[model samples]
Target: MALRPLFASLWRLLCSLKLAIVLAAAVTLLGIGGSLVMHFNPGVFGDLDRMILGRWWSTAGSAAPLLSWWVPVGALLLALLCLNTLCCFLDWARRIRYRWRKGGEYLIHLGFVLVLIAYFWGSLAGFRSEGNRLFVGQTLALPSLPGHFLRLEAFEPIFAENGRPVDMLSTVALLHGDNLLARQIVRTNTPLTWKGLAVFPGSFGRTVEGFAVHIAGVGRTSFSPGAELSLPDGLRLRVLNFLSDARRLAGGRVARGSSELGRPAFELELNHPDGPSWRGWYLLAEGPPSALTEAGLLLRPVEPLYRPYSILTINDDPGAALALTGGLAMLAGVLLALVSFYYKRGRGDRPEVW
Candidate 1:
């Protein structure tokens, strides 16, 4: 009989609104502190969280087992808050069982519980996201999805008249083995979602690509169309056509205009009496050079051409739907609770709604 009274007292204490408020305040304070600490000291708490929670950790030295003192304390407080919320809900349910007019308050509690459930579920199973910057034709390996890779097929940037980029389009593909699973075009505001992953266009920048030819007397010089050079032996090397961005024209001639500098290329002709005349095309970005050594002369590429590319971020969240649902339910509950509290009332012995 004595134990029964003590149990009731403990249950009341657990179900009290004061306990809930204290726990909530503690969690909020802890979250603020954690955010500040993480902002100042990068990768410390991140590494610790990954190690303890077994979540995806991409930061450098994330494998190091170093935990902050506040992590366990904050976790304990969160667990207690969850328990308190559940106990309060049970108490509320019991009191409101006979009274059907106060259904809105019950809904409010239920929505909060659902939101908490989503948070816990996400913490346990959700993977961290990272951003990747890639050039066209470059492939990036995914850490979360093994045997799956993402490739950048093309990046198109729309520039304003002032030479400033205003919008970007990135085309990417998800491939497993030889099979392509999905293709996505990520835009400025539109994110592409595929296989529980989302790719968002982060930023864009231009890259230069062209051929740097080296001569016997001269160290190195950039070669473009209409460029004429006289060799030390009286022979002549002329760049017949230079295409910063080359595309095949109607008559099979390679040509480029001002807006075609995305893929640089060049075509050259060399005249030497001893070795006759040689002509070939050289693409700056990709493919093998047309001819390295010809006509008793050596012409090699200094470096590959450069082009613009988009930086994309890939993110995954399993609890996104759940969280969104809970948020909507909570909003609805709040509105209903306000209406019920102001309108509904009961007889003596019923506690006041505050």
Candidate 2:
């Protein structure tokens, strides 16, 4: 008999609205504190969205002590709030008979509980891979989704009148071994989804191919931009820069004209063992292969193989559907509650009954 009274008292405490209020307030305060911490120290928390919460805390918690302390406390408070919501709903159901007028209240509590559950579950189980770069015709294996691969078919960027990029489109194909499963165009805001996996086009950039040149003593060789090579007679050759479309300005200066393959040029530097170093630009459009009489270097621009690459982010969120359903249920509950209130007011019915 004494144990029964103790159990009853604990159940009553669990179902108390006061407990719900306390947990909500604690969670709100923790959110405010967390926001402040993240604002001041963005580097520590910037990658949190791309990590699994449970694993991140296990591995990175020690590295970021200032932000780690509140995670567990906030999680505990949210768990208590969920429990309180469930208990209150169950206690209310047990005391009153079923009625359509009270359906809205039940749905609100149920949706709130479901949303919390989804959040906790997703935080522990979600997977995210950010900044996966892929050149055209390159393939990346999806570790989260076994037997699947993402292939970049094409990358096209639309530039504005001033040569600024307005939008970038990436054509991607999803494959399973030798078979093609799906293909879609991924943009900045539009992501490609397949089998719970989301592929978002993060950004794009251009990369150099290589510069073909022939040294006086050494035979033909290809070197990429920023490459340093040792030539015959203790001479060092350095590829300074490469421009796809080189345009000569009025002041005898060269600038990139456009992204297209127009007048390609390679800036070369040759260092002598005991003399002054020589640097000059080799424009491929002027001639085929020419010798730099000053530096005794023969250079030719290789066909401009400027390849554009796309950076993609893949995410596998298991609880996204559940969270969406919960959100819809909450919206429906709010609308129903408002309708019930107005209907009762028009009839002059007792508010206590609702």
Q: What is the lDDT of residue 164 in candidate 2?
A: 94
lDDT of 2 by residue, 1-354 (tens): 889999998888888778888899999999899989878876777667778787678777658876778988899999999998898778767866745566677678878988988888878887788899999999999887789899999999889999998887999999999799989999878889875678998888877665566655677677668789887678887878888779777875778878666777778787889988777676677753233554555554434445689999888878778887888888888888887887766767542310
Compared with the true structure, model 2 gives a TM-score of 0.70
Count of backbone clashes, every candidate in sequence: 6, 0
> Which runs in model 2 stand beyond 4 Å of their true positions?
93-96, 211-299, 344-354
Please give the CA lDDT of all the candidate structures. Answer: 0.69, 0.79
- The digit string of per-residue lDDT tens for model 1 on 138-232 reads 99887767888889999899889999988888889988866899898888888877645677888876655456777656568767556788776
Evaluated with TM-score, which candidate comes out highest?
2
Clashing pairs in 2: none
